[model samples]
Target chain A: MTLNASRQRLLGPDSLKPLNEGFEVIGAFNPGAVRVDKETVLLVRVAEKPLAVRSGFVGLPRVVSGGSVSVDWTPEVELDLRDKRVVRRKADGIARLTSLSHLRVFRRREGGSGWTPGPALLPETSAEEYGIEDPRITTIDGLHWITYVAVSRHGAATALASTTDFVAFERHGVIFPPENKDVVLFPRMIEGMHVALHRPTTRTDFCRPEIWLARSPDLLHWGQHQPILCGLNPWESERVGAGPPPIQVDEGWLVIYHGCGPSQGSEEVGAYCAGAALLDLNDPTRIVSRSVQPTMRPAVEFERNGFVPNVVFPTGLIDHGARLSVYYGAADTAVGLADLSRDELLSSLN
Target chain B: MTLNASRQRLLGPDSLKPLNEGFEVIGAFNPGAVRVDKETVLLVRVAEKPLAVRSGFVGLPRVVSGGSVSVDWTPEVELDLRDKRVVRRKADGIARLTSLSHLRVFRRREGGSGWTPGPALLPETSAEEYGIEDPRITTIDGLHWITYVAVSRHGAATALASTTDFVAFERHGVIFPPENKDVVLFPRMIEGMHVALHRPTTRTDFCRPEIWLARSPDLLHWGQHQPILCGLNPWESERVGAGPPPIQVDEGWLVIYHGCGPSQGSEEVGAYCAGAALLDLNDPTRIVSRSVQPTMRPAVEFERNGFVPNVVFPTGLIDHGARLSVYYGAADTAVGLADLSRDELLSSLN
Candidate 1:
């Protein structure tokens, strides 16, 4: 079957308004998308920084104890600012993000082209003092469960929150603890258990960044973890993580994931590309097939250069019967979209 | 109150047998102790390494998939081996331990001075692939719950297991995820909840190593985390963690904890010392009083030099009416005991 491929930029940093007069939007990307009635809602991660950064200082923004955003300025000489996203202290080797992120809602009519931005979901708890980032949403029994990365002094942990409607949300503390991210829950329970895919980073050299499966009786308490997949091909040799909630197909579960490999021009940075995998229908933990090459790469100008270069981080996937729409973060700065025929995407995985 | 202080080495690396013919015990320390019937049971952490290392290579030991230990050899030139405990790769910057650790049982009769070594607790699950270390035991309702640091590619996570008798253990999986350790469970439930003190390390500069409180209805699922205590004084400024299960006293909960500060002679290494703190009786999260000065430091010969220098890491504490016993790992090479008057120790915290 022939495939019709369409790609475009959905939202850029310049398109969205800042949180306040003192802050500027640095990134508007990595949206978690789901269809609500007649409109498609996008929970976009908006990274913001203080508008006035001193000439000789680096301002680190965080949510303080009273739920107010605060910026702490450190002298430029004390920081190693080689990376655009992070600032590392020279003395203690401690690192902090250059900007803070919060989830903002965006919506578009079923057949409309233009999108309208709505209210933001800001950091509320101590666990999200730094930010809440890269949300992945899954609707289970009518409730849209949003899994996002909660950044705090403890580390980057996966936290869960749910909403019957996008306007009202209930926070459900942390599910997976620190040094973990990229958690995506399946749309429904598999064999009477809630299944999720997560990427837990390793401190030791024995393991690399790979996707693991966990089953929970309740979504809050996760256990029975098993390593399902790891980086195998050259394009995904460094790391791999689940992009969106897996979609059930006739053969099995279709999974879209992002893989980080060595960049073509830069040695220090990684080029993130999108790939596909299929898990067994009965047992989601067992892998059925995986793409030998990346399905999508940093081919466009928006994906090539920005706050972070050469990145196409897919975080949301929407299945529309015969077609699928993929929402991704472009170079950590703006949101981009890619649409492909469902049959063609499945055949490419094989 | 008149105080009587006595310190002595109970077990050293030379005294314990190695795990296998090819492996040699490098360190035997950091024990979790509890009273069982007429005897004191100690679960000592035993660190072991391969007997032979190539002249220009460093050996890293870890538990492989089939419950067997294996060693990987890497060129010494590619590793930064400045630290005796860790070897970091120069290219990728990933770090690994030089030795693998397992828990071994040591039994001593009441009022006895000798410790008889027994069966070892080896790494059985994938989570404990790098080995287990620093176990803390607290008995509640006739069952002894053991909280230990399970090291693997995933990082140093806290895992729980329980036993009615010390011989057989039922693994309860990981209660707290990676980059966390130093977990000590309270002997009994407070306000109908099981309380635990843990140290979850941070990847960012926002937080330092501090003791935090978490409550759970069941031991498997833990939540409601609150930061309790952090290092304040110079002698305990670098980091702090709970030593053992807190002893319930008339005034409050008396906690023994370890504090890491700058070493007297070495600028690169930290000196681990023991201190005391009192938490509010009703709310264990509130700090009542803490010691401004350490109750015990690395003053003895065994504590001053060995696998890791200038360290006296207290892992277990026992109360004997008017007297108290502090069991600690000395320089990560030997186990030492310190005796202090119960009344004097309580007064010292003020």
Candidate 2:
């Protein structure tokens, strides 16, 4: 098994106490983490929904202007409300959610084992009308930079935000166009150029949601995009995306990623699994080895039930010199941790 | 017995399933009601507590200001947090709460069997700094006049609000000062003056929280205060309070109220039971006859277990000619109902 049961910390939505007295932290997962000095600063994506009374129907609380809240509701029969973590609205043929998303940063100091919350980052621009989500952090030249998916009616686009203290942030506008997401910037410059791994969509392409490599002279402008990886194995026949920043090794660059199987059974609809691929040190375009099968798949109950069930999407990775800590969202309900030996993963890079 | 156990409807906070979606409606009891045309409109006091991840301690959500909330937590070692509904700071001292209460109105049309939720009424005014709870509705000539307890740090005071459509409300300022609660206005004015049944506090009085009567000409200015009844039997050795608006009957004004025993055991601390009494038609201050014992007590699991265990506080009643539907808060969790013959209760009154 690529991931083991030993030394795992599954931080569920319950892990986050009430944001304040009235607001609840429903989903505290899909976090972006970086080791900052004596702490692991986690840019946790926390989804907060308003509190309301429920009878035959439910009243959903929504934020109004001027710091006020208003409630809206739908009868149990009128709406097919199934999951507690999701707010779904049926359109055309697919179900969509009406609720917005925001991110809350948490700092877990080395000595203090628990996560302490910080101020919330909300969707401010029209590009982020649907709210920003699922950030991936890369610390370059001491400053921690976050690349997240900005969603709106236009589609999903990559946006950048940088912070040193995690309290204050500098916005760097949308880095990619619509119908694109799962973007991650390399921790350091490669061959004197900034490199980023992202998944781009092509309507007619058989292999959809494939990971690609792009080089940029500056962090903003990009060019020479090459399709680096596609869904190959049966476990990854549906979609594949880069997970965390590639870890540098003597052999090459160790890249961890997530993939899903073909949509067949209920468990396979969106079941996520983790895998690793090794890329050449000098030229990332050259692939050395790739895992033939998923290194890790959903196993525990926490990974089997959530807003989206049967999933384990790893996003945050920290090298503790001896062991590697993988921080991932368990079933899209909570932040989970799985530890692996650094030496073992390096030897089994394929 | 004054009450029968046939064909019951008990609603606790758990009955509110939507609130059960992402949050927990710890208590949905102590409701007030009035028959509006073919609909039975109920104003339910719902106490929602945010779900927090529990380890060594859990943070309790509390309302702050500007429609925002905050949390104050105590470690499990320092504070005794046994009850899922309540949070107590100390073991021996008066128990403190970590939740905020809000009121939700539900309209159950005569033809409709279940309660359909309406808009939620939030704590807006300064008088309702903490919350507005356990309302009693009196339909005078046309409009439904609601009198409820406004709780804050200052004290629990009596406040008034009138609604004609149940959609719009006209707030009438605080009618009674702090350290007072359980205010219910009479349906019809007697002696060309408005009469109200209330519960007043007297520190030196052995029978604390006794029912009292007051006369008002304008409904705002009250006078001629007189204690109507007090705790009598061992089942009600602690305190008693007026329930819903007294029903007008031929024998006299029939009143079904709640009482509690001495809070010596854990089960009895907040244990509430229902009782009945008859008062003079013209002079409500004079109790014609009162129940020698409790008419109804916590029996079902829903009534005996909740945020406050063993609590059955009756606050709403609907006359259906053949049978009286006594709607009550069960175990301080959900709404409950019990059917009893009108004639039986009148004859059983001692």
Candidate 3:
């Protein structure tokens, strides 16, 4: 427990711009990258296009079931991926799904037709069959939130929309739904409310999926779920995420995560580096000092070298006062950089 | 959650008699059965009398220096026993020198030669090196409690010793010391304080080995803890225990435990049923309902026959308004009987 170092990059992913509005941009992979005002935003992973091709797959978005609902896809259904239990069964098998139907999100905007994809906010909830994916962002008193993950047919949750400018979005349906995801949220209002960082998982066998901590006051319900870190051991025995939007430092609030190795479900190989903990800025679920190791990993070669390899995730972090940067995302196709200082990643957490 | 049957049998295994007065009484063999009033206790699993004889093998307990605390009792230590981290580092390296040696506790009082085995609660400190063994007893309001599992060299804790009558015991020293054991206590006092049922064994690997829950504003300083009961599926995927001494009725707090299947460690087998859950007598960590099976199993033949076959092990229970008797102990050797009707075990937990 002693993290302080900082520095990694891809922040303005590449000269900014992009949101030319043609719709369909990309790379919000596990984004959530926040920094706001001084710039370093990005919730961008967008994926929208479809004016002709109907059979080869069009745009997908029609869902309208009754109870366990989740059927959105205009491509006229051809997707099945062998139904792992038709969205965890119950009340009939209800097909018409899609799961990895091509994720979304996009936002570099400055006035152009190069990015613009956004909205689809909780679109047909149930996991979109598999479309929503990573977002992050932060802000508080002036609005702007994000959080993302969504998936569908009926599983994977996270979500939480909001927006005061990026064009318009209000959603909020799932604040921390289902088996949970990497959620971040903790930019401000520590004692006045809103604090996040969740994980959830456990089907039992004495637990394994760790990292919890809720509280909300009004960012849409949420109350003290608690728990906070317990995942098996040795640098997070298999799962551990949430890497950007947390910072604040002087002595508390840190965060910076990503600790894999041993996962077989969401495809986790390892190393995206960085680790930290220090919470308690008025009970951010206490903690106060963590980081058994990892202050910035993936060395370089665009963070190690396509759709998935060594990896370098990040998402966003800017710092300023002592220069910290960190905006990753490399093996999922482009965007990478790095830097240091900020007490060398909180002195490698002890 | 309905439980209310009654009859009576608070302790057997011959209900405390041994006072042989010298120290060699035998019998103690896994008496984790619980209960506390009119008396029906027996945490008996005794196996004392062995200190040193390595080569010619007399009492087994070698591993002196650098060999790390000792206790190999070699047969190649049961042929490697599936390397559970070297069987938990050889059970914490022979419990740091047999938790300090020399001990005694053998009751069976009536007159004198009829049974003699007391006088040795010795060890003013150093956790009796390796003394305390199977005790399980509970009483609540009027006092009379005991939890045993103590050892030494710093390992295997869960030791609370109390007594208003059985003769002497008042020690309270290691109340849940090392790595933990099957504690059990919840005979009364749910909202007023005192509620135990421990089982700590998390040698890492991200948590497994559970069954936690503390609460004791005074029973001697326990706090909230909470885990309740995990290690789910397949009649307990191996390891789970807390059977005897939790029965309340009027809907909730039944307990009856003992689960262990995939063995090699002490040659595992199964049997011995009776599951129940429904706490919150004022927030005993909530719960409210559980027990999808097992209300009394191991059918017949003194409960499936002896030294460790099937195994029954209840410890004690009484109720007696008309039904609910349950004294149990069968496989570790004698003392059985079974009755039903506390509404037929709360209608088999619905």
Candidate 4:
């Protein structure tokens, strides 16, 4: 039941090899975890940047027009590079990621401690030109459907892909449009309709970013959107999003989500923490219970320092009978795992 | 054929009465025009602000939770009101519109010089809490479908409403998601499919705003999105969007669209001008011809000043056999009419 006592650092940037000889792995985190037979698979988000160095310039790697990776160089004087992960052009106030991300598979035996890396998933379309990040996997109709954020010139949109075998995959085009991310599909149909939890960011500041529920006859087109949750507590005052696919339980559908708020040390940067909420079994739009405070916070060294500091973003959850294992990205640099008793976690929510 | 010689200021804020006793109309422009039984109907967007004001505070009027108009007052010291139309909170950098908008119907009989005001359309749903602006009407079959931008905390989304007689309307919810606007539906079915031109804004600076094409079986659900036009010329270097429904002509479907570029006097604000393009009759996605330079610019005195400077946004185009009448919002403060020969406009496209 003691979360911090059972937590461990699982994987770091050094755990995976770079996609190409000219690239260097900068971060490996935010994995979409799922149990595949006897093995535990993690679709870890691998962020990479060009290894070559150029004086007084920053390089942005992206998938070019011909499906090849190219680096665009910009002068350091023209950019406001205050953030390590993003560089903003001073002229137009437009931002570009310093590194490109793609999902890489890592697996281990059910009871093994050592993990092994497998074949990687690279950016394939114009929508994924910048990169794809933060995937969540849910199984439905004997297929593992993966939902992730696709970043490009258009915007950060949620895209769907499915796989029966981890070796090969089929990509389903964008399910949610621009300014949307953090999509988690339920494992099964709810009342004969496919259900999903998505976070849509408003273009204007009239509303805060919050979690919304949507239903579809087919997974491609979604409608009947209902705003479900908003940031209420001080720890989650900024925004909230669905972390992983919800797990059905006796009480209700247990949802593990991420809540972001103002960091204690900075005004510009936000601190991301994990929280829990319970939705009604039949009607997921109705909230049964929610955690008043974050269930887990970024306290350890790995979660406090890296590409982005002071963050704990959970994107995967695995239920092992009485216990649950939560996998999260630590500081946008490494992967971290935490264990908790299912009953204790459910009881903690008010 | 000579644009400036045939242009005249049609209406201004002084033309319409305020919604209530304590409010004053600020801008009455951006009317969606259509021909109905020998009468030219204009759905004018009327923006209003609280007339009663106090020192050192600004009042923002909106439809509250209980479906009543209320004004939230904020201290002037805590806001940046450099822009006459929008006020940004200094604490969080969130911006809110200074005025609220609603669509009002205006009718002008054939051969008449004056327009008479008719029934008004008010915000009735949560999606339109902030307001509704810039409506484009297209008649197909027996009903006239009106597409407008619904602004709320959720973001600026395109909402569909249809009217049989303009006295009663049926709301069809949102057809496109957040960060999208400027939706113009085709008059009829295109190859057994309903076609539309929309402009979706990107969340990040990775891409410039451009016009896109989408098709639907029904008016409520839209899909098959394709990027059809982008800001290609210097006059349209910032963004471009479909202004009115494309008119079927001999060469192709004649499209009148709005394009924005850097203003000569200011870098912060852009100058909006109108341009023309030709799309294939069968395939609306193919660009047959386009105007290299803007066909119409903000040249007149009324178009160069007011709530928003340097704006001449065309929202309605009516074809009258050999001639066309263009109704545009000039400077976001008044309506302007421009008459052009159909043949001359088509020949102007490159």
Q: Rate the local accuracy (lDDT) of all candidates.
A: 0.85, 0.71, 0.52, 0.85
i-RMSD values for every candidate model: 3.2, 34.4, 15.3, 2.6
DockQ of 1: 0.33
User: Candidates ranked by lDDT, best first?
Assistant: 1, 4, 2, 3
Candidate 3 segments whose C-alpha is farther than 4 A from its true place:
A1-211, A214-238, A242-269, A273-297, A301-350, B1-211, B216-238, B244-256, B259-350
Alpha-carbon shift of residue B53 in model 1 (angstroms): 4.5
**Candidate 3 global CA lDDT score:** 0.52
Model 2 per-residue lDDT tens digits across residues A144-209: 889887764334557888988888888877665434567888877888888888775432222345
Instruction: Give the Å shift of residue A45 in candidate 2.
Output: 68
Better of 1 and 2 by DockQ: 1
Clashes of each: 0, 15, 89, 0
Model 2 lDDT, full chain set: 0.71
Lowest summed lDDT over 10 consecutive residues: which window, candidate 2 chain A?
Answer: A89-98
lDDT of 1 at A321: 77
**Fnat values, candidates in order:** 0.24, 0.00, 0.00, 0.35
Q: What is candidate 1's lDDT per residue for A1-350, written digit by digit as tens?
A: 12345778999899888985599998999999999999999999999999996999988988988789989999999988877787788987767888999999999998999899887899979889889999999999999999999987666778999998888889998877656789999988989888899887644444567788877767876666667888888878788999989999998999999899865654356889888899998899889998888888888899998889889899988889788999999999999999978888889875
Chain A TM-scores in order:
0.97, 0.87, 0.29, 0.97
Q: Candidate 1 regions off by >4 Å?
A: A1-5, A202-205, A263-268, A281-283, B1-4, B202-205, B262-268
Candidate 3: residue A290 lDDT (0-100): 69
